[model samples]
Target: GVGAGGDMPNWMTFLISDVPLYLIAMPVAVVLMGKSTVIETRKFNMKPGMFFKLLLMCLPMMWVGSMVGSMLSLALSDGEATNRVADLAMQTNIWNVVFLVILGPIFEEWMFRKQLIDHTRKYGEKTAILLSGLAFGLFHMNLFQFFYAFLLGVMFGYIYMRTSKLRYSTAMHMIINFNGGVLAPWILTRVDLDQLDKVSQAAENGNVAAMEQWASQNATGLAIMLVYFLLYGAVILAGFVLLIRNFRKAEFYIAPEELPRGVRAKTVYGNVGMVTFIVLTVLLTAISLFL
Candidate 1:
């Protein structure tokens, strides 16, 4: 049932594809890497205020990355870019919500933040964060998602590095996915785009009657959309301010078995697998923009 046409339900598709990758492939890979890669479990505890501040501080990066990605996609596709991920996100349902808002964060954090970081932290904390973030972004294999995913990945990676707790990063990831994959889509669905387009045309042609008719008919939807955008804009602005205030306070520590500064790049990228992954993902991302 899982085909190119996306005939299968979202949960079923996730089970077939994502479940296997998380449960089987990643575990197998970790086991092959040996006992040294095991992540030490730690209690998850972050002050509510700290969590809120961290979230706000990272929002600007998310906003900027999203803008860049969207602009690049538009340019590459000559303004005809189609985001299949956004299309899927718009198909709001309980199953989709559960997967996107809950299960996704659990599995993804365990894989990318917990597993990948555990194995790579020996190189250096910064290196581990960057590696996990870059890999996470590239793994999406979509031009529209790469930038923001990478930015958020780094934020989550830092949280996990500092706390050594999956729960912290997992919770943050959940909130983000909930916003993008659930709440935003729901808000968008409340508005009728076709009618909005008609209303816009009417306004452009100075058709007062038609424009007023739309305003009256879709008052509730308009209000909902207006509130959503206003709140979103506020969050972005707060995040930008927080980022500027906290930029100097950010910290990184020397990692165990840290690589030398001069050879860190070589140690990380001069590998057969990493090179192959970067090249292939870049190609796929580029191809996705065209598609």
Candidate 2:
């Protein structure tokens, strides 16, 4: 039903469909789960340096997850897979930026990190984080997003656990969304990709004159794209180094009601509801990839 507003602007569609679901349905679901499941707001006090460090460490993970998801989708669909989210990002406007970079993160962090983690952390911090990651991944219901979303969800969940504050995770979410939904798209819009492709084709065919003509006209755009790629590559490399250096420092606390290691899998996934949710999401992801 969320997709039913296809004729409307992206922001309007999201407001009419997703806002109600997040603002109303999510809270109602939490109420139905019982008051004990509610998460109380905590002070937002994470340092800027710490946030940057966390974000840097997460970059490589996000890159890897995205690569894996793309590879799997291409393999499954014989290289014909399409990413709707990416398509929407490419079409982003100011209103879309508001929803994608701000409102989306606020509601999503509230639902996935704050609410879900609070409800499940009683089982164990690790368990809660894993569940939150998996659920967040599946919530996308598309193969293109599941892996990167899952990895980011786990990272955000860890941040929430350490600070017991929504602001840190929410801010992190906002930054990532802004990069993907706003900054990256804006950079891409400056480049004439169709002309670039033609230039490439001309070069491959030994038509140097044609390539030079296109380059002369679009040199600035090419320079901008090249700089973006270089900067992005540097960040990704730094992220990998940070991830490796800090991997061993990661810690998980045992909850007071921690389930036994032997039964933890059963405790988390043996339920009918979770199994059904997983099955449905997997089916949807498969459909999105192949059909």
Candidate 3:
């Protein structure tokens, strides 16, 4: 469904599948793992003002990742069509900006990062990382998204694991998604939306003379734009590093007793899960393409 169902997949169907399931299942997920997700931070604990220090430690890494990830998403994610979709989505009569930014983060963090993090512990962090990422990405229910989202999930999972603090991951996730995921493409799609199909078609039809001229005039411009984005991303990185340096400090984790034990050590995955995800992803891709 590259451009089917009016340029965005039928999110309504996912709303059906995901919203109810998550609402019902998330509470269950939380209840199941709530007690165990909490860990003993005593070993990691620090003096007062430690949270700020942790944030400081996290800031640069978050910012660096943000810049690089944003650059990748912008440079590579979609062509001009994505911008148009953003415009269309934004133009919705009830496009409440605050909800678009906040609701997604809160729910996703709770379900994907918090709950998933707590539950998959016994399988080992590596398994948890893959499962959590796969779960987070696949939960979105569409193809235009699954790959990047899964990658983002993995990254967020790492943040929680390495830092073992919910706030840092929460904050970073919100900013990244709000800016890069939700907003950047929103703006980009509207202004830069373009189609090169006519030119490509002409070229294919032996209009090489015109095609060569178009490439000569436009390719250099495109190359220049790419260079500008790269430099800008670097500057963003520098600022991020400065913030990190100023903010570095030791931190602690929450005690394990605060969290309840998850369902069973028996994961729904091991080898079976990977194969299942691949199959489902392929099937979804086919459905998206044909349906």
In model 2, state the lDDT of residue 142: 72
lDDT of 3 by residue, 153-209 (tens): 776676666655566556756665465445454444333224456667788998887
Give the top-scoring candidate (lDDT): 2
Worst 10 residues of 3 by lDDT: 79-88
Assess every candidate by TM-score.
0.90, 0.90, 0.52
Clashing pairs in 1: none
Candidate 2: pairs in clash: none
lDDT for each candidate structure = 0.80, 0.81, 0.53
Question: Candidate 3 lDDT (Cα, whole model)?
Answer: 0.53
Badly placed stretches (over 4 Å) of model 1 are: 1-17, 35-44, 203-206
Between candidates 1 and 3, the one scoring higher on TM-score is: 1
**In model 2, how many backbone clashes occur?**
0
Model 1, residue 162: C-alpha shift (Å): 0.5
lDDT measured at residue 91 in model 3 versus the true structure, 0 to 100: 39
Candidate 2, residue 287: CA error in Å?
Answer: 1.9
Q: Under the 3 Å rule for N, CA and C atoms, how many clashes does model 1 have?
A: 0
TM-score of 1: 0.90
- Cα lDDT of model 2 overall? 0.81
Rank candidates by lDDT, best first: 2, 1, 3
